[model samples]
Target: MRRFFLFAGLLALLSGVVNAQDEFVTDSVLLHEVATYAPYKKYQAGAKMESIPASQVEIAQSAGLDQLLSRFAPIYLKSNAGGLSSIRIRGTAADHTSVNFGGININSLTLGQTDFSSVPVYLFDSFDLQYGSSSAVNGSGSIGGAAYLGLNGNWTDGARVKATASEGSFGEQLYGAKVFLGNGKFESVTRLYYFMLKNDFPFTRTSDGKEFDQENAMIENMGLIQELNYRFSSKEWWKTAVWIEHDWHQVQALMSSHPNVPSETLDNKHIRIWSEYENRRHALQYKGGLGFVHDMQVYDNNGEQKIGTDRLIAEIEAKQDVHSSFGYKIGAKYKYIKPDVYAYSSDVIDHEQSAAFYLSSFYTPLKTLKLTVNLRQELVTNFDVPFTPSLGAEYRLLITDLSVLKLTGNLAKSYRIPTFNDRFWPELGNPDLKPEKGMSYELGLQYQYCSAAIQTDVKLNGFYMDVEDWIEWRPGSIGWEPENRSRVISQGVELQSNTDVFLRKMSFNFRLNYSFNPTEIKEDQITSLVGKQLIYVPKHVATVYLIAKHGLWSAFADASFTGERLADHSGSAKFPNGTVLDSYFLMNCGLSRDLKIKEQDFKLSLAVNNLLDNDYQNQPDYAMWGRSFRFTLSTDLNFNKNK
Candidate 1:
């Protein structure tokens, strides 16, 4: 608390310090910085692309939320339960992809769900979606890929303000705002957002031959973010940021197939705080931070009508990095995390703390060629730690100023440690369990041109995970225990295409993503999940988007397809092998225009979601909301736009 107040005072004092100095002010930075020459755009369309300093990006996506989500059949996919669930990257399991905001890592407690609505889409300056294998510098939790979100800093002169409001079908409303303040010596950025939806979905089937009223759910989110950067010296900088988010959700929805599952209600809240500092040496950069999070949840279960759970966790990390003369950049990092969980009935105190150290190096011997290598190790008191290694390379051929060719590949070892709830919950303690480890490989290629560009990237990754003393729970067995799972192998391939056509002021963009996986269980008698396709994992999935932009008018249309998936791990008849839901495609369209009022910039947009009025569900057997429309208006005020 003392440190917090001290930092606050410094920020207050530094606000005036910047005014005393004179400097050329840049525009307010976005939260994340997209990359130019992005690998994924090789074969997709309707992608918002940008370029940042290459060294600044370890692994990330270079697209914005609006551009990425607009390409989907549905305008948006909601993950309201925990973390950010329902995340599918090239048809891989949600767990396969790793997501990070700023520098904080988030893990979900619930399965098959995530909280996407809470992410401040507009505040992010750039996003990097690294597909294939895992990044070693960020640790060993990823097998599919990693998505890194970047927040912007205050650099604009005077103040910059932006506000947006939108209304759509089903009582949907949205509001968002951003403010940037800066002087020569001090800078600050703040953001606010609110979204609400009262969806009235129409389902195709009902047990009583009557369509259900649709899942009625409402989400209220409040976020406060303040970042202050102070120049301790010309080469040294001190920074502190506070972020708080509160969500209130109420749901009275019907479960698919299990209509008798009863209407359910839940209330969940999350609070997080983080602070960091960075300094630059003659040739090295040093950075570190501390973060804390608290989660409180209450829900009604089938047997236990009233149940609640609370969790608190703290994490810390520090790193020192350097970029060398021959385009070689290297870094080392250390991290520690500890979490505590409490339930309504009894307080089960479980702690999972890890100390990790990693060394990573990237070298570009030639201007068009790059190579990267990484090695990492984790130390855990109660579990055996493993070493992870990764390698990647990128080659670019400059055909002409207007065209380019690129090639990329990667190989890595990754692992996932069971969460506290996964290993120590009252009804699910599995002491003999071992962490699952994976090895992955990927290769891709790209081609580009001036007027039109098309790129195709394919990744084939094979992974064999061994869970010695694997843990599982049976309904009538001797509670929860551990058993050796012998062997598990999961393999898949993901292919993507993105292309853009530009002629004078008109442009067209298209994108396609496809993925398939075949997972095999080699252990007999481990009936729980043996011979079963991983639950919630679709064997085939794809999305196509078409968009055009001309002058002040821009429009987009998209369609997404998801194939069959097993509802449970049991290979039994509960949900059969091809008991798949019919594949459905949805289309949506939107238009936007900008206007100048006095000295302010204003913009308006209207979108008609589910243009085809397709009745579809994202999850198997689940009831999805139907056709809807939305309209949005926004304004931007830059006091120094002319400067």
Candidate 2:
């Protein structure tokens, strides 16, 4: 009854606003206005960069980052019963892929991986995925690829407010609010969000094949972000942003037999402050920024284990457009990381520092040919960092008024440093471990066609990567210790296509993506592991989606499929070949309605996830949730009457 009253009040307010307006606004007109004035721009280089569109972002804002990426992108996510999730790209480990926020690396230095489950999709205005080796554009540890998230500072000439509320299965609830205010020269933006979930869904145990209800699984999270921008002059501006977040989760057991005892709990806190200045008045444009991050994690079992990390980052870059067909960029970056662990007997306070310099040049010799070269050098405190270099080329094969064909290729060398836990852990740390090194090569072709009625794009790419001195933990004489003891080879092919057709009063969009990645342990100290596939790395994955929009209504359906994968390494005797997980398919659908009143826009959306209720597991023994449903209500209002 309360919800009904609230909705009724909102409808009354909207009706009043509609009566005050001079003309009725259609959804198509609003969409066109947004597209014409939006500040976000997609990357257009020859590299295989994919940007998430604003429409898709808006639809996925209620979901977490992991769910959005796993369903829409070609990446793979290994989730443990929807509680803890990690990402993999191009058949590489989680640590090999970097996640950056506003040009700062956000991965944990102690764990060497980012937990995708805890990240929110609404925190950033734009998301970009760069495939293959990107250590040249991004920093180190990008052997597989990189993901970039950024907030656009450019604001329109008015003030706007947006709020969203959602409720879903498993006792899920979410609320978010954002405010944008600008007056041409100065702008301010703030966002706040809160989420909670019981996570007590039922699942079947893979070992015994018995259904049981999950317990002791609850999550609560909240975050706040504030950004300020000041345009000192027509050609220069300054921007600053601060973010704070907290998360608490209750841990659950992997199997029914080994139920959680003493009730484990985990808590995480993160704070970041970043600021930058840019000047583009002269022929040479330059930008610089400074950032600081503080992260803390605590786990409570019988006792408490706490870890804290502090990072300081500084970077500067300059770009010069020497001519119409050529340009160059030079940059330098420095990072210092300090970590403290309270659970270790030994003094677990340590610091690591690194500095890197890079230079990139782009040349166009002919109307249809372009080439790029990049070089980077790094110096670390106690480790030997390698000198990385890469070369990329693109050529237009054919060009016409309505169609174009292009070929692209890239080759690069990259490396990853060992984590602090790998080198400084009590009694098991290895101080002499070498950094993992790898080389990657890729080639692709893209074809695009556009006409009055339809537009289509298709791309096909293949990549191969070879790594030496791969790091792994093994049973030593004393205890388990980290070592560089294996060689790996990963090769894959990716195919993607997108089509959009415009009709009289409706539009149809379709997308298809598929990846075939096979990673193998070619050489290992243990003879049994050689010539075996890497554990948890699937060989085949595919996704498809179709969407239709007509007037004020829109609908979409999508599906994803993941192939079989080994549960454990071949050398392990605890699990045999039968422990492999079978392939599974997941389907989802959504329907949404849009409404406009004066300068305000309202949307109501209903989404059904896991529509088939397939019982499956991304990780062995960790079952996933069944079918689930969610409903969301969101509104955007412009408060400035001058518009």
Candidate 3:
């Protein structure tokens, strides 16, 4: 009780650190930046894409990307005690979803996936999720979905700085700082963050109902993003950004272990550099970019295993207006990858060079109807990848001042190339593997209504996808070797709603999302596995979130539910007839208050996760952290405003 009063007193005292000023400004100027060669434009449309609200992202600023997405997105995240988290979209495998950095696919060349735990939610200015298969725009490896991440330039002709400090249960500490500076022509965005967790939380054993503190689960992560934007004229500009991060973690033993013995550690480092130039005009608009990604990781089980990859990419694209109702884009891209690993056939430098061409056209004969056609072709050395083509159309059903309804549909073909580990892992690797090809169909209906009293949006979507020559690892004569084995089928339905209600002095926003996904193997050598749902894939997921805002107070709550998942066959009592994991529901909530500390803006927030503190496990033997509380304080100062 005394500590609470002292904390309140300190907050009150800090609220008067500066003199009052009337020129407190809050807004940034959105600057034009060159595009990074994409075949399908978002506005012209191909898939169901949604952007995360900036206001809602504030609560997860210090948390990882998995935490943020788990609160809103309907996809399942196989989070291993908050340690190795990966995304599985609509029952698709983690590797099937492409994680792109500024329009460039940056999934590991060795593992063919990205660790969601390695990404900080505060690094990017904008985050978007694209539903269904989008290989026509996102390139290879997007068999299920894609996430586009980038930083936007907000040159507001002023200097602003914000510092954040947070502390949570179980020895959680977070510190971050952000700076934004603009001089009309030159703009800079700098972000730095450091977070650590001594994950020594208590957990109960599922076997005998005993308890023990989790051990060997410490994590320390830090990152930096430095972006600079320069404008040459009203229609031309350049952008350069550098991102660096390091994550060091100690692997935790399973909760079922009494004297836990897993003492492995993971060390990961990432460095990314990108630069782009865009010339925008009436009809002839073109963009060009050069980027590089450097990733290295070391894992220790009994001995240290090291792997690293370096990738360089170059792309250019131009768009023009052919007629009043027709437009088209042409682009070409090239990527080179080099990998260093100890499990390879040889230590010799092995480099892969690939080139691709992208073309798309947009036509709108009437104001209420529009169509787009996209095609992409790629060439690799000594291998063949199927050419991809897609078509999308949108038609407005009703348009008025109070409401609008639209119908959307898309058909696309996609493919995924074999990863380096699948093709080069000593004798077990299969150099004769083939690319996985897939075809997908989508249909959606969207309705929106807006007025002074309320605003609402509802969307219903369905997708069916089939993949051929799916790669699988099997026991061969030499060992486990990769092979093009099974044909899989995935289908799902999604329902979403976004609503805003305005009262006299208060406003409320509600968001709901739900999906029913079923993925099964169609053809496989193992007959029993055929027609069975993929292990670790869930069939149902949903999330509901609410945000409320008043004069100086705001609050948010998120509730998420995941249905039963198919567990791997163990032939035990627990899995006598292919039994599975049980469903789980989780909730997170936060409350925040905004304050004016003289000339600066201040915010204080309190967040709680797993409010119910349910004793549950995502899978067998892996226990959750139960519940945790976090308190954060942020201060921002702006200078040279009204420029």
Candidate 4:
């Protein structure tokens, strides 16, 4: 406790020294920077798209990407004791959700899933979540949704630099810095971040009722990002970026029963470089990129395994505006993927190549009505992918100075190809597996109200999806093999609301989001598993956050609730009538004070997560963390020689 008190006292002293020039500043520096971007424009006419601003992203920088999503977004994160985390969107499998960074797909070609826990939140300036099927625009493997992380190259007025340092529970430390430099014709932004953690939290085993401390759990991560932009002419510009990340972590045992297992480790490295050129005068754009990823796992019991993947992508697009009421986009892309795995005393290599052509048309015949149509066709090397298409429409029902209401609907077809592991993994692979196909439908209503003192927004959406040829691994006469044996159906409802009120000297913001999703296996080859809920899928999830700010001090509280979910596919003798995980509720609170030291700005914040100390697990035998605390200090510096 001495350390806490010492830090608190130091902050108080600094606050007092900086408060002499008391000038009320309502907005944050991060928010001010985000405002420089062009106002967000909807890419999809009727899709459910949510963009998280830079200010909010900064609030959760120390917690990684998975924690940020679970606290604020409607998606679900399946965590293994804070080790590796995967995302599930709208009751879909982890592999069904596509992750993209700056127009490049970052999902692994071998495993087909991206680990959200390994990604740092500080690398990207913007986060966008697109709900429902987006295969028409994002290509295959987007059966549920798509997530996009982008870096904005729009520089500030002059040159600026920002730095942050944070410490948290379980011996976690983070340090990062960002630099921005620009004039009129040239601009550049560079970032460097490093984080380390020792995850040795204590937990109690549910089955045996015994207490134990986690062991052999540690993580070290480092990343760097560089972006540059050049404006050759008023209508022509070139942009390029490079990103590299490296991670090394020790793998812990699965359960308390195996605490004395041998040492295990996982290492990963990734590198990507991309460039794009756009000429608005000619209505043309061209982009291309190359990425490389290497992964290695060392285990005493299973020997060493290494996997490498390389991706090459190129695309050219054209846009035309025929009239004031209509516009269209046409694009063609080609992608080549090669994966090599070294396991089982041999080397396995495979190739996947595809070419896709897409066309999208938008029409605003009337001021109150808008329509969009999109179609895509892909030709794969060894698989026959069906034609995918989507249609969406939006109409304004009522409009006035105080309130507005809008209705939107969409229908789309999507598909996911089998991964390399599913097709050729020694004795466990099945080369006859077929791709999973899905059809989805959605309808939504949105209402917005604005006034001098208050602002409110509400949205409600309902969706349904049917999938065929769902892949599953089952025991065969010889051994376990992957097969296409199940037909799945999923339906859900989403509701969201946000309200902001401004008083004489204070402001309050409230946000609430809820999702009700139930996924089931409608038809299956196994009799015992038919008509059962899918594993690790929750029926209901909800989140709420309240913020209050007055002058330089601000406070906020967040609450999240997850409903009960099944643990396994079928019941067994050990787990009577099938294992089910109970529902859990978590609460978090934070307080921060902003100070102005001359021209620079400083902020100190203290946060407590899992306030109630809830004991729960998203995956069986993997206990979650207890109550934890985090402290962060950040500052921004501006340089202007003329000033």
Candidate numbers, best TM-score first, in rank order: 3, 2, 4, 1
| Model 4 pairs in collision | none
Tell me the tens digit of each residue's lDDT in model 4 across 226-289.
8888887777788888888887777766656556744577777788777777777763443343
State the lDDT of candidate 1 residue by residue for 1-643, as single tens digits: 3443343233222111010010111122111213432433221111212222221121011112422442431122323321223454433445555666545555454321245545555555555665544536456456555666566544555778888887876666677788877765677777776666555545666445666545545545556667777766677776666666665555544445434534444555555556676666555556666666555555643333322223332334333333431322334334444343443123444344556666655565666666767777877657885688877766674445444555666667766565554556566565456765666666655444332232222222233333222223444365644343534455665544444455678866554544565555556465554666544556655555556778877776655655555555533364445344455555666677878888789878777766878765454445665677777788888875334
lDDT of 2 at 76: 84
**Which sequence of candidate numbers ranks them by lDDT, best first?**
3, 2, 4, 1
Clash counts for all predictions: 33, 0, 0, 0
Candidate 2: global Cα-lDDT? Answer: 0.77
Candidate of highest lDDT: 3
Residue-level error in angstroms, candidate 2, position 470: 1.1
Candidate 1 regions exceeding 4 Å error are 1-84, 88-93, 109-114, 117-123, 231-236, 255-263, 300-340, 344-350, 366-368, 396-401, 451-488, 522-532, 569-579, 641-643
Looking at model 3, residue 25 earns an lDDT score of: 9
Task: Tell me the whole-model lDDT of each prediction, alpha carbons only.
Answer: 0.51, 0.77, 0.79, 0.75
lDDT of 3: 0.79
Candidate 1 at 608: error in angstroms?
1.5
lDDT of 3 at 472: 76
Which pairs clash in model 2?
none
